[model samples]
Target: MKSSEAIYREALAQLQRLIEQATAQGVEEAHAAALATADRYAHPSVRMVYIVAVEEAGLLFFANTESGKGQQLIDNPRASLCFFWRELQEQVTLEGDVIRQSVETSDNYWRKRPRETQLAAWVLPQGTPAPEKGESRRQVRQLEQALGFEPVPRSPNWCAFRLQPERIEFWPSGWPRMRERVRYLKQADGLWSEALLSP
Candidate 1:
């Protein structure tokens, strides 16, 4: 039997390979995944988000702190994510607790983004009421003009969060709805355990 550390490494390796394959197969938004979060009241909400980074510890994504998902994550740090690749007939699910990334990390990422995108972020505060028609674009243009040649600054309310997954499951499609499911659960000692689930 493999040790917990080995199983954990293998699961992450498998995920990386799947992500690469999906991208090679021309799947649009290959990094996109459905993120599920719940508020303090335990009310659940889900939305699609692009997984910006896949680290050994977990995955990372960004959002406005005042957004619904961000508020929910702050209130209840646990969340789930589901990634599906129709072309590869594969799916991966992750459940984990989230932690905000450091200010420096967020700044680095924000600096690398295109200027227009950064301006759009400033103008489009997530989950906020929509501005009057054309107001959003105007705001972006106005901000850009005001900033002149200076680099766009990162929004104080915008940041990234890392989801340190406690459970990860990989599903490979099989004929006639039969699928093979492999799950890895993180152990108390910070390792992991592997299991095969009926599908």
Candidate 2:
């Protein structure tokens, strides 16, 4: 049997290999594939998907407080997210900086949301105290009345922030730990360079 340390080392090796493949493929493709996989495994209660965005200096997180998932982001802004597509025996891992979405960007994404979602945004405080039951219900009713026939406007709180990825990893499961990994670093000229990692 592999020791705990060995298992961890194997995991890291797998992660490194994935990064290399993802980087070579391009960030956009990797993100799309990974997100799709994530959606499949996502639980209904997982309202916000953890995203790591880059900034001028470092990373930020965009996560919902409802499930306390934001706590993980806060504690470790640097993360390695795994997406496993069991049927294909494929997996991808992303490790990079994360940041919260800005109000403006959030608003843009908010506008694309369904009216019901927009209403829910207004009903929830997001990282703030939950309102009293009566008050909450009253607010919901008021919003419904105000928007009677028309769709509700997007809330300032419901926008998506930008996450600039510094690195991404992609790996397909196999024996001998010969997984493929790739890495990307945003250079001074704003171009990303891709490199392979040893597994």
Candidate 3:
């Protein structure tokens, strides 16, 4: 039998490989796991899900910047994210504090949106009462007419928010009902110390 240290080293190696593969594929790919789990669970909370982008001091969530959710982040910057991929049999849980996106960063992402979507930024009040559909459509049409061929302007509300992760836990479900769990705590120096937990 291998020594406990040897087994741990092997597990750590495998975990590193998986992380590298997931990162190379991008967060969107990681999000696929989240989508699959969300589909299976049919959770309403997952409807507007996003990968938690974290800094040392804040949490971030991104929307059209015109959506009510964006305003909520601006007002209250706390969030928790749960991600699961059934095929891979893995899950990640994250909780953190958030901050509003900087104007320059918001503008950068805003420019990438389609013109119609950019215009929609102005039509929505974000986190407020829903506007009448007919009235909203009319306003959009009017804006289109007024703007003619010019590019749509970014609303002051359009932006991204940043989230700082305080705690992160990774759970990998094993076959035959066995499972493995690891928890990481971020240090002041930005390093993480991981601990294994009983499954």
Candidate 4:
């Protein structure tokens, strides 16, 4: 049997290859994923978030600290993510403890965003109800005027969250019902190990 560390390295390489291919093919949502988070009581909440960064270290995504999932993440730092490449018939699921990124990291991503997005982030109060009807559109207009072409600042509460994965699973479809799952788990020695799980 191959050592877990060896298998993990191989799988990560395969994953990076898949992501690169999907991106190159002009896939609309190649960088999107379903992120699952739980609250203090262990109740789960799942939502889709754009995948900001993918690397050997782990995944990085940004969210407002006041959003529903963000609040949940604050209460319970454990979370998971699922990335599916439908055309390629492949899926990667990752789970780990969530930690806020440094101020510099969040600012870096913020600067990359469009002016509209940055302004919207400022005007939009996540997880809160707003006035009904055209209130949303009106708010956008107000936000645009407020910024007046100036640089949109990144919110301190809207920093990036990094997931240092403890588990990484790749599920690729096979003929009929013969599905396969390959998992990489972090060992106590601070290295990742791998195993196959029954579907």
Candidate 5:
């Protein structure tokens, strides 16, 4: 049997390859994943978010701290994510504990965003209700006028979160009656273990 570390590396490599394949096939939002989070009460919420990077620790995504998902994550740090590429008939699911990245890391990502996006982040209150239509658009316009070509600073509420997955499963389908599923689970000692599940 392969060591836990080997299985862990294999899983990461497999995910990266799938991402590359999806991009090559011109799949729209190839990096997007459905992220699921729950509040303190265990009510679940799920939405699509772009997985910008596949790091050693896990997957990284950015969002506003004040957003519904963000608030839920704060209240309950456990989360899950599902990535499916219909074009390739492949899916990956991850379950993990979420953690906010360092402020400096968030700032770095913010600096790379387009100026318009930065301005929108400044004016848009992510999880709040807007009674008036185009209110956020109006605010963005006003903010743009005020900034007047000045660099838009990153909002403190906007940051990146990483999902350090304790469990990850990969499923690929093509062969007839040959569906297979592989799962990797992180052990308490920080290593990973691999299992094959009936599909």
Candidate 6:
């Protein structure tokens, strides 16, 4: 068997490959994950977030600054992410501190988004509200004319968060009641300590 450290390194690399495979296979929610965060009062909530980037620093996702998850992150920086790929029979969990991304990085991503998406971002910073009748459509049209052919500047309150991982666990399911799990945790000096868990 490979050493636990080797397994840990492979687990990280496997995530990138799995993401590519999911995209290639036309999975609509290829980069989706359930992100769990605790609010200032220690209340917890979980929601789906589409991860835009995965790097050594952590997983990157964008959210409205004042949204419930965003506010929770601001009050309590630590969070956890769980990714499950049904087709691949694999799941990955990561726990870490969340850090806001740089303005330039957020702006660059914002530019790559479709114009309509940018408009939508402006329209709904929080979850979409059920406005009375045509009120919502009215806002969309107004935003369109107001934002003609210009990059939607990243909102100061709407930005990206990167999870600076301290612990990572990978699970790959097996036949009929069998499974395998491996965990990797950061050491005091930044190296990762790895272990296998009985399933």
The Cα local distance difference test for each model comes to 0.90, 0.51, 0.59, 0.83, 0.89, 0.82
User: How would you encode candidate 2's per-residue C-alpha lDDT over 1-199 as one tens digit per residue?
Assistant: 6553443344445544443455565543332322211222342222324333333433233445332444434444434445554443467555455556667666555566667657767787576788876887788888999889986776543434333454445555666668766554455665555567776
Report lDDT (Cα) of residue 41, candidate 5. Answer: 95
TM-score of 1: 0.95
Off by more than 4 A, model 6: 1-9
**Error of model 6, residue 24, in angstroms:** 2.4
Q: After superposition, how far is residue 152 of candidate 1 from its true place, in Å?
A: 0.5
lDDT string, candidate 1, 1-199, tens digits: 8988788788888988899899988889999999999999999999999898888877989888899998998999999999999888899999989999999989988887889989988899887899999999999999999999999999999898999989999987755667778999997888799998987
Models ranked on lDDT: 1, 5, 4, 6, 3, 2
- lDDT of candidate model 1 versus the reference: 0.90
The reply for model 2, stretches above 4 Å from the true place, is: 1-81, 99-104, 127-141, 174-179, 185-193
TM-score of each: 0.95, 0.49, 0.64, 0.88, 0.92, 0.89
Question: lDDT score, residue 37, model 2?
Answer: 15
Question: Residue 198's C-alpha lDDT in candidate 2?
Answer: 79
Candidate 3 vs 4: which has more lDDT = 4
Q: Which parts of model 4 have CA positions greater than 4 angstroms off?
A: 1-9
Which model scores highest in TM-score? 1
Q: Which lDDT value does model 3 have at 124?
A: 60
Residue 197, candidate 5: alpha-carbon lDDT: 90
Evaluated with lDDT, which candidate comes out highest? 1
In candidate 1, stretches whose alpha carbon ends up further than 4 angstroms from where it belongs are none
| Model 3 worst lDDT run, 10 consecutive residues | 32-41
lDDT for 51 (candidate 3) = 41
Candidate 5 per-residue lDDT, tens place, 33-149, comes to 999999999999999999989988889999888999989988899899999999999999999999999999898888998888898787766877663888878889998999897
